[model samples]
Target chain A: MTSASPLSRLPPGPLLVLGYGNPGRLDDGLGPAFCEALRLRLGGDAHRAGPHRMTIRDAFQLNVEDAAEVADHDCVVFVDATLPGPGTFSFEPVTPSTRRAEFTTHSATPAGIMGLARDLLGADTQGYALGIRGGEFGGFGERLSPVARCHLALALDHFTALLPRQEGRPTVCATPIRGEGVHHD
Target chain B: MNPVLQTDTERIVIEPVTRVEGHGKVTIHRDAEGRVAQARLHIVEFRGFERFIQGRPYWEMPVAVQRLCGICPVSHHLCAAKAVDLLVGGESLTPTAEKIRRLMHYGQFFQSHALHFFHLASPDLLFGFDADPVDRNVLGVAAAHPELARQGILMRKWGQEIIQATAGKKVHGTGAIPGGVNRSLTREERDTLRAPVSHMLTWAREALELARGYTLENLPDVGHFGDFESNYLALVRADGAMDIYDGELRAIDPRGEILLQEPDSQRYLDVIAEEVRPWSYMKFPYLKPLGPEEGWYRVGPLARVNACDFIDTPEAEEARQEFKGLAGGGPVHHTMAYHWARMIELLHCAEVIQRLLDDDDLLGAELRTEGPRRRREGVGILEAPRGTLFHHYRVGDDDLVTRCNLIVSTTSNNEGMNRSVTQVAKQRMEGVDRITEGMMNEVEVAIRAYDPCLSCATHALGQMPLIVELVDEGGDVLDRRARSGGS
Candidate 1:
């Protein structure tokens, strides 16, 4: 509810943009798509350490081992695609779950991941989840649906807007990098 | 192992087994006298790769098969590519092509093994298997040993980086072609990988030490946990050195004596036969020569360690020596040893990757070569992270695939996994009226030793359902729980 920049209030440590989902599947790729867009807009310096430093990674899905990586970071953002939501995107703060985490298969829940980060590594890493509504997620293709693309644009705008902003230098989020204006149904 | 009980009793079903890579369950039957009746690890997911890939072109086999599972896509990609290579380039590959493929495979081993040990199995090893299920995961391991957990993640990340450097992407890259790779490694890519060589090796050594310590602590109880004697199968080089990327099929008896060592993977049909069960979608693969019941053999890390005479890599060989010493010159029948063998193989992967990085051919100009399709049918067999994987294909003259038969590593270990569960169940659950969650986890711990990738084995996509239940005599469910799991 606070208008403060999420990046500015974070503990002094590296920021991580963890994108996880099946890129091979259509709309499920929104996570990586968002990360790729962020990388392009932020330039190569995004990987380097600085006041605005951030690490970007993409995986098919979250695994148990990701907890340690998440714990190492001072701040973490989990990007994923959800089945078409009432809203185009939903950004929620993550808190460790008290319910015992289940190690089932390859995937771990975002809350489970955060819980592991906090409980296991004794990390105070603040976490947030950006769930972008996905239109299509079941096919074997990397392209996003039109509606999903629109949601991705909005999610990117909201994500970049939360980052520590600098004066004079223009932000890519201010303008459409894909040359396509965000669409509304 | 106890015989199946004929008396009426209760049944405890741990369905949709958790933590492993697929959909499965552990069922423990109790007899009238409150004794353990029978236990089985059932893989319920159906595999459709053989049917769906019928119309696809032979060239697309590598990429098409990689989509079967998100984990270990490189194994499928590289194995399928080799089979495709046989169709295009006879028995041998060009020097550069062979080295690059091997390099990629070593990377696959490094990543997959690191994942299994650090993320999957270490929770059980570091924290006791009976430890709170909530705290028995990578996160839990991290909480307990932060340094080791970080090392495991970094090691796996390095492995993925190697994959991305060689292939185009980390998950499912299209760098591999029929006769060779899509391109040679760039100087920058090579340097990036080279910088972490020593650090990776150091981390691997530390991991090996940790595994060795665990193995030593559990050695006394190892014989009681999934300790069933059976045949072992793996791919070994001509000299019987452990070879994961490419080699001849080798089968050894419980006594560690060679039973059958064949070079041609195409002749696999003559020796191996698949049996179907009404209860599970997974096929029970057995040695045809021995016939179904007596033919079942174990594969994966344990089998490979048992079947091979020695590991070629120095560090791995040393570790192998320490591992085999536990058995006093016989195959290690202890299911728990799978973790030890896996860690040893992990060392070998890092060593092999480091060795491959030193090869100049990896940076060669000639990335691919083509030849006429001399054969209509080709079989690619490699030691996948879990076990020996077989990819057989029959192509039409037009180059489209007519038939596809895949025997994944998990499928090969199907019978053994069931036996292991039964063994553990019989040992732990005997004379118990009720089954607790911790008791059920013991059965799962046995199956976890195999590290079965049920999705890959059954070719079932999406989330695998997991259910644990307690059924009273006459098969009425008393208690049940389910989890939708995907990884």
Candidate 2:
């Protein structure tokens, strides 16, 4: 199977991990830290040795560029810290639309930074959204919520699955809860 | 529920209301040494346009945002288009789109700058504050200097015509799209613009000479008064072109020191903070680097002049020469010379608009990208007639906007203008417990010089009375006056 036109031209790369969260808040740093952890696990040697430069892209304050970057890469993994709602990590593979307004940095959100990434990347970009529970927000600290720490391992397992694999031409994994019809698994 | 309430004073209590385009009053006890009393500016109507616009479709964002102000809607439209272009990457439109956009803005510049100068500020310049307040308006100016008044109206009207032709609508237009404009200009429309351009230039000279007739050495006392100073900021191209519509943000000190030049708009969140006053609907915007209490900076004409070293055109350069003379020397920091800076801008706006009308691409019909606008969440920032305006939004999957944030000039200049008011109130007020209506009106006039869009400044207003009162030391009320008429 194949995607036509613009979607067919998604960036050809080995591994792309996208971290989306507000750096100014406390636990939101979970997204960036997850990317850092993955970096430490894979090491720069792996990215440099590979064909593309998909090390880490942190959208501290997400803007339109978040979508553009994702569209330009292959095998993209999205990471973010979720707000403390159900006291659990919602690990879901999501597909999102390229519409700029669907994703946001604030409230009542369905589509997220990861969804934006998938929308831009098309089939060339394999995307996932991993969020840890957030307890204290608005303050300056990079620690996860108590409930999120428990599910950190689950997030890592999902994250690692995509990094080890090659750019599978047609990769579909999990149902996207927050994603628009732009991307589907 | 009242944002502005009275506090203790020596004898009377005063409640002041601040606004988007202008300032107000709250007076109390005087200095320990005894000069003027405590006065607070209550920004009565703050239209949290930034907050109100959340969740709107991206395409319509600019149109709605442009309505936020009557003075600089043109700039708002252009800025919105510029912002959307960043995401759309219609770089295919490049220099042509860029130049045409600039030309459209020139039309805005011509119209708005003229209105502020001739219709609003010119009355003050031609007639003294001491000149019977009843007859001291545009009508009075027409009755007095008929030719100048007529010419002023014509010049401003021509500006409106330019905008109408370019955007398909006059006051608030979304003609500028991501790829380019939604419409094109034909030769006939362009041809009609020629006479107005010549007519405005001739009238601009007459207006300048009229202003020059009242030199600083012998001018009305108020026009010659003022010494307060604050930092200035604006946008400038890397090559030094005037960046009023699409340039990097820059800030400079009164001494011409480059405090900040070509700063990133994205980083504006880091360096700038919006201050709120519950009394008035307007929000005060301050430089974040200076801290909440300390970062008070001025925007608009006086600030614009103080921000840039020179005007963009040769005619404006000559007008700048006259501006220096009006100040009796260096940068005129007085609230009064906001009039002078305004006139200079009017002259420049006309000249620039003329230059754009001479451009070839403005006639091109190809405007939009035929491509469905995919980007939904975007920010549109521009220098409006008052100051900086921001339109931010989030879209839903269906391309319908979900949320929005609109930060207009009224909000951006709120803090500093409020601070500036305290100075003027002190300068004009004599007794803390017996403030007069004229004194309050004087303060209000000081604000109208900016000609802020009250609708944009105050999201809501149902005949809010303009009240002036005198208060005592214990913040007790003494004498109070409220009127509906602005002038």
Candidate 3:
């Protein structure tokens, strides 16, 4: 494991996993699907009640109010589906964006929320964006695409291995499986 | 960004208007003499949700329709629930169910208005329209007026909490069921929400003052910004009091003459008609009697304030009086007054929420009601954050929805928004040597006044960036400039 990267050393404080996208739209449900998989993998209440102090939330899209919830946490992982890219998934750290020149209440970016938390709410919360590659986003349906489902499984496996294992759960990896870092913008 | 022209007659297209909800583009055509000839707001995206929900079971409507919008899903949720109430013979809900629904609706209004004013519209009002783009957003508001920005965040948070308490969750809540809500507000939830009422009301009042002061202080410029006389429509109580959750339809002309007033929600089709234009995906809804050309009217905050006889709440009623005085006893046709009117409604929602929280019915055991007979067809109408929203459905004997038609707030204001763009285009773009960022924003400001939610109107989803293209008279592209992200 490379200690030079922030992802190598997880924050000891409270961590929030926020999965936001329109679940009604096909493939867009990858974020919530990841959260669901993480929850089930961690067992009932293990993610939240465990020693890691992690919280999971699902939303249609990030908005202005999310900053408040994000501010209370030491770190937040914003998960969403992305168009076809170089890999199955990309996980990268995010910083407060100084170039966000406009505001839309309907949707907000992870960096934008972090910026709001730091600037308006006086918070120093760290943020990360996890984009799972998906094949379809053009229609409305509850189910994810077949390829997106495969990517989701791979993403869940890769992400859960990085988490602190539960008492009864299987062994986990201490380092990331891949080093491909992609920005969600 | 580069500005260059190649022809005397050309078209300027502002694709994906910023700051407002959904993806929309504006096209302004100039004549040979360089005068603005025509301006049209085109809704580029379309989601046939009305057809998408046709075969679904009637019971799934309240939950299914929430997918139409992410910003105001509660509005769609409650409106569809109201329509489904008729399908299941539950039009007359129990006191508890009605009050709970009212509380949820008010929470939507409060949070939606707060977000619009503080996050979307405040930058333009605080900094002049021509201010630098870098320092003209909520962050800039945070840097300059930290306290106001904080209040905006907290106020929106409190309203979302109210939704979480009444509804099952914040996003895609299934609290409002077919006959009634699935759950009641627990005493603990009520207490948690009640504790923040006074502060919200205080903040709402301060925000109102800011909007009011801005409008009055800039009357000359604000009044003439896309100013025009058009009919206003909204739902009002029987005594003509402003009622957002439930009431009868009322439309009034610019001269304050009552154009139409129908108490029966089911008979809405008899009085209103929608005209479909080939250029835009959205339909223009007009009063049936006046026909399409003359009947295109405005809806939403400005229209609601003008259509009602009086506001029920004390503070908002007082503010309404002052707002009405601006027109000297007629409808306030100034488009920029929408911000001021929106703040008045925000304060009113706060007061209404405070009153609703004090009622014991919210904690009551009874949450559902049923009528003597079922209905095959039903129409639900309510004043959403933007304006009056209509949801109509026809159910088959098999319990499946056979047909559905929804006239979202933005769709209703389609013609009005187009007119606003035309007015602003003429004022800002005509005879201009070069098109500046400020000029583009001035046109957008007029559309922002309506606070149009294009996502709900078109039932589509997509990100929008600001793209302005100058097209020659022969449809050739002369120049193009693009800006990433929304305002």
Candidate 4:
């Protein structure tokens, strides 16, 4: 991690993991799915789990109003599915975006929201964009695609390791994937 | 491409109107004489949630339908919950259940309105209408006026917090269900929200003040920008006070006289009907008695404030009085005044939310009661953040939805939006064959006033989100533009 990265200077508290996207759209539901898997792996607690306890939330999409919730937390992790290559995912640090020209109430990008948390709410909230590559975004269903399911397992293991480990749980191997800024699983 | 003759009339299109939700295109046609011939705003995408929802169980509607639009899911959630309530049994809700739903609706309005004014509209209001396109957005506003932008973000934060506290989560919350909600408010949650109530009120007042100041500064532009007289539609209480959650549907003429008042949502079919135009996927809804031409009406904050007699809240009432006087008691026709009215509603929502939180009845144990499914057809009507929303569902004897129809706020204002775009084109781009980027941006500003959710109104399936075309009188394309990436 770079020394200038905001993620390096987080305060003491449970990390906030926010997963947002349209769950009805097949693999677009990966973000919420990640939150669910993380909760179960951390002992099935929605708000707290394991040694590095974290609060988990899932929503259809991000909005400007979400910056407030981000402000009160020490560290945040935003998870979502992207239209990139299949079976590939990236986890990159989020920086305040200065090029966000237009703002809409209905939907907002994670970087744009992070900017709001930092610039508007004066929160030292730092975060990462854990983007899992999605294959299908059409049709309304609560199931994931084949390739998305493959990436989900490894992605969950990588995120599970980021938190404080609890005793009696076996940790998965962490190996780097395809993306340049991605974490290993 | 063949070069058009200099003497021929030109067509101009602004596709993918920026700074609004979803995909929409604006088209302007010029005649042989170089005069404006036609202008229309077209809805481009069709997800068809209405058609796909046919086989789902009625109980799953509140959760399923809210996914139609991520921007205003609360509106859909509460509206669907109300409609499903009718199918379950009676139209009445327990006091606690009703109050919790009301608080959630207020949160929707506050966050939606603040997002519009501060992020979408402020850049145009603070900078000139003809300002540089790059400097005419949220980033520019932040760079020049940091304090104002910060206030907007923080205020929206409070609104979301209220949603999480009462509704369980901000987006696609399962707190609200048929007949009543799933849970009640806790004292801790109530006290936490109470602290920001006063701060929100103060900030909303400042926003209103700034809107009034800007309106005065640009009197000429405000008067003619997309200005047109039209009918109004909104929900009003029995006492004629503005109510968003539950109320009777009321329609008033252009002169502010009552045209129709239907106490039940079921009676909506008797007074209102829809006409599908060939050019767009959105349906045009109009009053049945007046026929299609004269039936197109407006909704949203402007219509609600104009259709009502008084506001029940004190500060909102004062603001409403000032807003009413803007037109000397007549309907304010200036399109820009929508911002001013939106601010007033924002204050009203904040005030009402505070009051509902203080009411100890929200903690009652009787959160919801069971009712047998007796009705096959039910209609739910309420005021969404954009305007009035209608949800009608027909279920089979098995309690499964057979048919679903929706008339969103954007569809209700379809005629008005088309008229506004035509007026702007005629007033600003009549003789010019080539328009500047700034002029195109001004046309979008007019549509932004209504804050239409094109994603919700869209009923057809298409890949392109926005496509603008300039066509000659003979239908030859003179110029064209398309916008990619969802707006």
Which one wins on DockQ? 3
- Model 2: how far residue B20 lies from native, Å: 8.8
Question: How well does candidate 3 match the true structure in TM-score terms?
Answer: 0.92
Worst 10 residues of 4 chain B by lDDT: B1-10
Instruction: Give candidate 3's error at residue B158 in angstroms.
Output: 1.7
Instruction: Report the error of model 1 at residue B484, Å.
Output: 8.0
Higher-scoring candidate on lDDT, 1 or 3? 3
Clashes of each: 7, 53, 2, 6
lDDT of 2 by residue, A70-125 (tens): 55566565667876676455545456543323422111122433443343233346
Model 1 regions lying over 4 Å from their true place: A1-17, A23-26, A35-57, A64-76, A92-105, A109-128, A135-147, A160-185, B1-7, B461-466, B474-487
Summed over model 3, clashes come to 2
Full-model lDDT, candidate 2: 0.57
Model 2 alpha-carbon drift over 4 Å, by segment: A1-185, B1-7, B10-35, B91-96, B212-215, B218-226, B277-280, B321-331, B369-377, B394-403, B432-434, B460-465, B471-482
Candidate 4 per-residue lDDT, tens place, B213-246, comes to: 8876777889888998899999999889999888
> By DockQ, highest first, what's the ranking?
3, 4, 1, 2
In Å, residue B8's CA in model 2 sits off its true spot by: 3.6
Ranking by TM-score: 3, 4, 1, 2
Interface RMSD of each: 4.0, 21.0, 2.3, 3.2
Q: Per-residue lDDT tens digits of candidate 2, residues B160-201?
A: 667777776555666788667777778898889876678787
lDDT of 3: 0.85
Q: State the lDDT of candidate 1 residue by residue for B329-366, as single tens digits.
A: 88988888898888899889888898889888888988
Better of 3 and 4 by DockQ: 3
DockQ of each: 0.38, 0.01, 0.44, 0.42
Candidate 4, A1-185: lDDT as tens digits? 11233232234475788987766668888888888766655445734633435678888778666777788777788999988463477677887665653344346777777787777678887777788887888776777777777677776655665554335744323543322112112
